[model samples]
Target chain A: MTATLTQLIPLTPPANPQLQDIRTQAAAYLQEETIPTNKNEEWRFTNLAPLLAQTFAAPNQQLPPVNINGLVIPEAPDSRLVFVNGIYAAEYSSIANLPAGVFVGNLAAATDAGLTVTNYLGKQPGGEEVFTAINTAGINDAAVVWLTKDSSYESPIQLLFIATVDDAAVAIQPRTLIVMEAGSSATLVQEYLHTSIPNHPYFSNSVTEIWLGDTAMLNHTRIQDEDITAIHIGKTAVSQSQHSSYTGNSIDLGSKLSRHNWEIFQIGAQTETNLNGLAMVNGEQESDTHSVIALTKPHGVTNQLHKCIVDDRAHAIFNGKVFVPQAAQQTNAGQLNRNLLLSPTARIDTKPQLEITADNVKCSHGATVSQLEDDEIFYLQSRGLDVETAKILLINAFAVEIIDRIPVASVREKLAVAVKAFKAS
Target chain B: MINPNSPVILSIENLTANVDDTQILNGLNLEIKAGEIHAIMGPNGSGKSTLSKVLAGHPAYTVTGGKVTYKGENLFDLEPQDRARSGVFLAFQYPLEIPGVSNLDFLRVAYNSRQKHLGLEELDVFDFDELVQAKLDIVKMNPAFLSRSVNEGFSGGEKKRNEILQMAILQPSLAILDETDSGLDIDALKIVANGVNQLSNKDNSMLVITHYQRLLDYIIPDFVHVMANGQILTSGGKELALELEAKGYDWVTEPQPVG
Candidate 1:
């Protein structure tokens, strides 16, 4: 039966120009690589049987209409961008008073404007994955943002990517590219929201690539909250230059089966990067987040912290790796993963690894999975808080270390509300 | 019928509690009325802190046999939160540090819980800020403390004062101070004691548990009870603390005449 099932699995076909350029490229790559079965290192804890069983229809050709009023930012409203199914919707987007020489728009349009699209597209590693290849191939539209040298955008740019589909078993791939020129600084928020009812099966595959030039700084926040029956696979790659700083905050709250891959490369000296992530899973949800920070240059620093809260029969997995090459002397890197299991049935698998060949580098990695502290809960309850309220409070606090670092207040408030609602549900 | 004029708000009858199957508070009995402060003094392992834990409904310690009545209600019948909402507070000896929960949010939730239990309208952020600020003054704590994570990096004294701040905000009918003075310096003790004093009223009572009488010096108690071997050996007026302070707890735990 297993052999028959394996044989029955459909393999992605070779690239054909007749097909959508994105999809053709993805299918060709997928055809060359093996499907990630349980034997694969990354797929050991996650099963793909459920996803393979369903027939996924491509995203609708015509963009679905979205209501601008529904995209309210409680704190900052003027600095926001709206997108539906990977296509930028200019009518709903608002970006007031952008800095000089800064360009932000749809990737296809940006390519038409003579921007360097081919130089950065598909440049990050791990594009060999079938889901990534599918995303590359099927991407209908994408957000392309470029910041010129010496420019600084005071207000954060909020990108609201909403997935709306009336049809069943549909899929959407949203690609995003952010490029910061030398001596530039900016903060950007990318939020993935799904407005679908429970038990409505859908799929969303997304890829984001970020490039920072010399002496540039970038603050990036990604919030993912999808429907319960959706499958989400997201990947973000960041490349930093000399004296450049990059900070990433990723929060995952929804999706039946979700996985996020974060790969950061410090290729220049004096580069600093901080990667922080938090995931809250409940019910039968299974979420996995894998992150890698490589320091290939001297005098670079990197810090990574990821936390997870698993409840009910949910499962969470975290794998963090820090690599310091031999020439990357004076490198400093640290990784920590903390998991809180609310129920005995809930499971969490965490692995923190550090491979440092540079003797002068300081590298450390640690992972811990623990339940809510009884003493802390008792302390709160003693002050009039009930068990539920106390638990919520503790969980919120546990996630705050990363949420509070969000550069955008409006996005932060939305995240806070979402957390409260999750606890209530 | 319960007497409205009665001074005692809490009455323990043959209370026995155990931790990990070992008896701590063995057949202990004590009483404290409103407007009066009582201190429980004992050596280590004498179950001074265990009494406070039992009163607060800590799950770690099991009450083998006994009854604790607060305000004419069976204290053990209510859950920890219910006990708290019913105006029973335990100021822990070691205050926990909640790294991500801001002090303001923690206080607001605690305040709202009490209000909800009382069927009163919950205070909004504006009113809660005002209320918390007013209480902060009593403890001499700075307004900056509100924005920080609860006891995340606070000093020993700050933690104790934060505990008192919560006690003041909750305004419980009975406050149990379990070793509140264990790690405080002179100034922090005074500040914490002053906060407690400002909150105590004619309708509320306090139980101060300590190994030293120095804490009672600042927030003087009206009654002093010597607890040894899990039972109250003696109870007397304020001067009894001075006597115990002079002669030490060994003097009281010695064989004494039964009344």
Candidate 2:
């Protein structure tokens, strides 16, 4: 550690006895650790020097009652939670008639006796990485979702975090913790939307921790479409028990510099994990995704596909690692990373790693980085589409491979339009 | 309307082209009148496929010296897509697989482009489905293939039939089949050839490029040209296919006395 992040940025912890231990741990780690540099293997392709140079402080202002009627996903969820500037804003939230056992509220407002937020509040399955430690130490309010055993919800739950503008560079940390007990199921749509705040470089440091018990299934969709001038560093830590299934669709379409880290672990046998990620970047923006899936038990199945479409002078990076320990016999794992470059200056760096200690497992990993095939464009052109139209069609085709996997129909349509508009520009 | 003395629809004079810095078409000359089917048969690597791609304005091929006239217009002056919109279609031997673009959507887009070119009304989804259902009879394909990605995961025979399906939808005046019978079985060959036969008319001409005489047995070409070393060595009638198949391609490449 070169320069301690805690000493550089002063954050005053709120007075909460239940969260005192977590706050103390976050502060200690932030003081002990320094910001990661390009020399770090995980930060090699992405340079954090520019972001580190900028001074960021939490935006201090009245929590704006931002109207999110236009920002919410189409066919809005029955239960919606909205947060502005990392603080819960109930004025802009709407909760449908949830079941009796399911509890959804802000972390700061939940009482110690009502909802237990101390155990899993800042504690993630993947220990505190550098940025996550910073976010945990700094964030005062967060969204806490808990579903008791045998509880199920048919309609998807929506969580929206809107970033309000400020005059100076501001750092906002929004934390989310979801706990699903055994034999429960739920669909979650977590989104981050940024308003066009002129001249303000917003830095959003967010963390999501999900724990699924035996026979539980959680469908998670995380989308980050912040302002182009913003910087976002998000983490999702997931742990699944026996016979549990976790499906994640992580998408990034905004921000000048963004990094998403997904850490998944199987604690019991016969668990299933499916992960699909799409990073569509243009201009000088950069998006990087690093996912690690560990199978600690037998009969585990994991399938992951990550795709990145880079245009202009942008860059994208993907690093996927699958670990199958000796105990994880008869494991089946597949990982594929594909990248498409639309310009000569665009770049992609992908690394898919598989560490297998069990000879009885079946695991495969592959990565490919290429521009659109000239033959494909010619093929479309020969069918009477002009050059520009043909290029757009092919570009859409490249994205559809990953977009089609998303379970939400409206979200898929929204992304399809964004892809077409990007091509036009 | 039954005029045997039809005007020439496509005339190629000294059509020389190169692909990947290697000359593939060397001063190739051919003239096709309206309502005529010309079949060019040669052994492998005889520039037969190159001729088909060059005519479709493939971006990779460079035309060094050639004058191609389609309907009295300089074909080189038109873009590849413009050429397609102007009623020229190429049935590819190896149809590229597009993973996400549905076959129905692709055909609709292509059909609309041609319809707009002629100032005709474009068909909506329902109307287009009705129109395409009628054209499916040309190849006897299952309607399920229409929803799948274009030629993706299709068998060799299905891909060729898809080409015929596109041909039926576009209804081009000059259609070029590039080795459409290469990997087809007997039943598939009959279906493909029958589709071509049904789509042929006095106003449109066909250029079938194949290696086997079996396909010619079904389509029955009017003129058979033997291409060797990037140039046509001889031209004859339908019987010429049988002669070439019996004597083998060696006769076309054998040494000949200089005039």
Best candidate (score: DockQ): 1
lDDT of 2 at A403: 83
Pairs that clash in candidate 1: A22-A137, A23-A137, B7-B33, B7-B34, B8-B32, B8-B33, B9-B33
Question: Residue B166 in model 2: shift from native, Å?
Answer: 0.5
A44-77: candidate 1 lDDT, tens digit per residue: 8887677777766665556678664655564445
Q: Which ten residues in a row have the lowest lDDT in candidate 2 chain A?
A: A1-10
Chain A TM-score vs. truth, each candidate: 0.91, 0.95
Q: TM-score of model 1 relative to the true fold?
A: 0.90
lDDT (Cα, tens digit) per residue for candidate 2, span B1-259: 1246998889999999999999989899999888999999999999999999988999999999979999999999999998999889999989999888999999999999889888899999999999999999899999999999999999999999999999999998899999999899999999999999999999889999999888999998999999998999899999999999998988887776578
- Assess each prediction's global lDDT (C-alpha) against the native: 0.83, 0.86
Which portions of model 1 show Cα errors greater than 4 Å? A1-27, A72-81, A87-100, B1-7, B119-121, B246-248, B254-259
Backbone-clash count (model 2)? 0
User: What is the C-alpha lDDT profile of model 2 across A1-425, one tens digit per residue?
Assistant: 43424432335656565666776787687666777878899888887765777877666646866657677775545578898878788877776566676767777555542776676677666656788877766656778778889998777788899987757677778889898989999888899887756557888888998989999999998999988889899999999999999999999999999999999999989999999999999999999999999999999999999999999999999999999999999999999998989999988989999999998999999998878777888888788988888878888988898888777788888888988987533
Candidate 2: pairs in clash: none
True contacts kept of 2: 0.79
